[model samples]
Target chain A: MSMRALTGLKPIPPSEITPREVFLDRRRFLAGATAAAAGLGTAAPALAEEMAMKLPAARNAAFSTTDAPTAKKIITGYNNFYEFGMGKSDPAASASKMSVRPWTIEIGGAVEKPRTIGIEEVMRLPLEERVYRFRCVEAWSMVAPWIGVEFNKLAALVGPTSKAKYVRFTSVVQPSVMSGVRAEVIDFPYVEGLRIDEAMHPLTILAVGLYGETLPNQNGAPVRVIVPWKYGFKSAKSIVRIDFVEDQPRSTWMKLQPSEYGFYSNVNPAVDHPRWSQARERRLPDFFASTPTLPFNGYADQVASLYAGMDLKKFF
Target chain B: MRSARAADGRFAWATSDPVRALKPLVFLLCLAPALLLVHDVLYDPEALGANPAETIEHVTGDRSMQFLLGTLAITPLRRITGWGKLIRFRRMLGLFAFFYGVLHLAAYIAFDHYFDVPAILADIVKRPFVTVGFAALVLMTPLAVTSTAGWIRRLGAQNWSRLHKAVYAIAVLGVLHYWWLVKRDLTWPMIYGAILAVLLGWRVWNETLGRQRRRPARVRARAEPGPAE
Candidate 1:
């Protein structure tokens, strides 16, 4: 939050590119109610496909990881979208009412030319599959192949002014659909933020699909950012607003418990979450396995230099 | 109250103590949740969902708190219904609470940490939530050990009764353990706490206001030694 210049270069692609069998064999897994999904189950295939976007993109080498992807069911079924409800399965069970169609994301704040981008146009932006290690602050993690356009590609569409030092993301709160919205779980519309450099980093992407299918309603449906280095909550879901701002935005978790959740919610083993240790994470399927959590979730080579001069210990 | 209980006793099959007839049913009912968890673990793994270990911990912990509260509820319920024989189930309910609590602790130790002593000790020490949870279980140990009729007879009913009152403190600690550990949304924990408060509030009311209402009843209550507490 203090003085630090972005100096990290893109990490060299590890020899272990995204495994083919990991994604290929997983096609048999059930796809949730998504119009864009290949096996569109419901009577109205055209309507569903219209609402969802199909990705023909191959798994990109650079963003790929060697880790096996969390089964699509677990990735789709077990979600932390508080809008649906607090339980892990609540999102999958309760998100059916959410209408992802007729969605438009408003981009504004300190940008040179602010404009609204529809879900269709947004999803069409050169999609690619990137497997990332998704770690939760609650000390569980999963690996998943996400299909989406890079954040920089989307950010390039809207020219940012010098005043745009930070990026604020806001998720839509539909009280009619989302029961958690009515429950008022830590403010209805979940808010998150990113430093301008972090936002522009190549590792960052706006994910729209998982396991080669359209994003499930529970899995942020139309759009969500995937910042592999940060905690999963930092990848705000059901996003409707992206504001380029002057100051760092107060994320929902940060607002709820500032001491526990920081603006830079980087996955750091040394900085333990007040309630639980961030040192080890339970990888899904291998639920009891104690896998040591890496700094920046093993993306330190690409992102650590961004925090070069600043003391990560600072309340800043 | 004695007259009501005596009158109710006439309908033994209808009310209980013929509680022997109901005991096995209640036992099976209590064992049901644990059985389902076993079934899920052994045959249908995914039934517990993505994190079965966490689910087991939650279910066992939840049932433990529920039975602990249920054990507390018996006295008030019996008093309200004028069914003295309802006292027979208290031991079973209490022991079940202890049983499920053991299961809860076992899941945490075996599944969560795989019996890592240093890690667990560090958790109990460093985390206030874990510490409170561990303390609640520790306090329950003596109560659980001394729950038998033989032990109650050895300890004397009055002393046994006084010792078992620690359940109230255990209840508080259990609720505090729950309240402290929740990531967000105090709804479930608050509901459990509310139930605990009501159970605790009933005793406080009986001790204070009920004492004035039935001054002579105090002598009668003292004259007759209650069941194995």
Candidate 2:
């Protein structure tokens, strides 16, 4: 079979695929372009990822954001994966040491079908692209095109028992590979949780890829949860365990600062962080300007009913 | 002896009128950080990565704290080096500290709050870090305004020195502001604290020793014939 036939993929347009020679010589092109554009007599090399891979196309139009997707470099280069380190760029620099291959996620607690599923089994499930607006509690936001299966699919496969009310997600905590785990910044094996209903929502996904390519280690490789309506930290990364529990799980941030970060970390602009205002957010790449933050990060229309009568300030 | 005197004369000439000779250099050095930030924003945007505003705010805030610490160190540094000329730069350093403090506040108001006065005021009142930082800036404003020679003369040297002692409090507040703002790592704030400790320690040590020396001289004066008698 031809390459396209074997892969069951359509042929890429010539204009879309950058030639290998041009990709190889991109540094020189970038230098000239940056010099001409800046006219500052200084050459800045473009921040191009060496591991180039083609990303998949968006599969779900309903879940995608109208906002332009954040650049791949910014999305991958800037991260808050404190498992690698504290600095935003530290994850991108140090996460390469992590081993994601042969990963397994253990499903336990109130699940009827408690089993350890391998990476291959998880990937084999139906996958779709979802463009999500990720709002950080730090008052910054980004939009990403993530490709993965819905969290409900995994939850259904495991079959949560009637007693299960909350689903807890635990990230891999290998001190040997992750240097940040060595620091006592927070308890290791970073844990996060979602209400069972929230986990079952169509918007929640077990993301494995972004921008059509397998997730970079910095962006949470292997598999991670993408909780669109909540702050980015609520979506646990590099997940290793899923526990269905009767009680709400004590997430890492909530455990660290109960008053600052609450368990129900839904994106609410009316509620402000103690240190910073949450009413506005500085969108990445547009550093000078800030736009008013939307309630539920602009996902309120779909998820508003989830917290219809609850006081957000009290919960927040 | 003649050659040594000649060499001293040449040294005096080289060091003469530090206000004229070295003030401009100190001014330029103080202005360099702000200029670099402006250049990065205008021409080389990527130098600050995806969030230039945050980077600018952080850099300016850090520079302001560094200058505050630097201003505090001038006296101790002069004592160690015996470079009386160093005294000429103290006012410039203090002014630079105030300048960077203003810039830091401006960045917060402009980029973070977007000139939202009520929001800015609310943040200062609500956040402990912002409260302490705002306190430090408020303390610095008077010091910067009364830094002129005329103001010093008007206040009298004794009152002027007393009023300026608030800088020590400002330094402490600045460090506290930094420590409170950081999420986890305390390395930078700890370093700033250590430096401030040494500077304050030197001042306390000198004051104690000077008092002891003055007491003995007073005793000696009593033993001798009184000049009035």
- Best by the DockQ measure: 2
| Candidate 1 chain B: worst-modelled 10 consecutive residues by lDDT | B1-10
> Which candidate's lDDT is highest?
2
TM-score per model over all chains = 0.85, 0.84
Q: Residues A172-194, candidate 1, lDDT per residue (tens digit)?
A: 88899788888887786899999
lDDT, candidates in the order shown: 0.84, 0.85
> lDDT per residue, candidate 2, A88-174, as tens digits?
899988786676755899999998999998776676577888989999888888899898999999988989999999999999987
DockQ of each: 0.44, 0.47
Cα distance off (Å), candidate 2, residue A234: 0.5
Candidate 2, after superposition: displacement of residue A157 in Å? 1.4
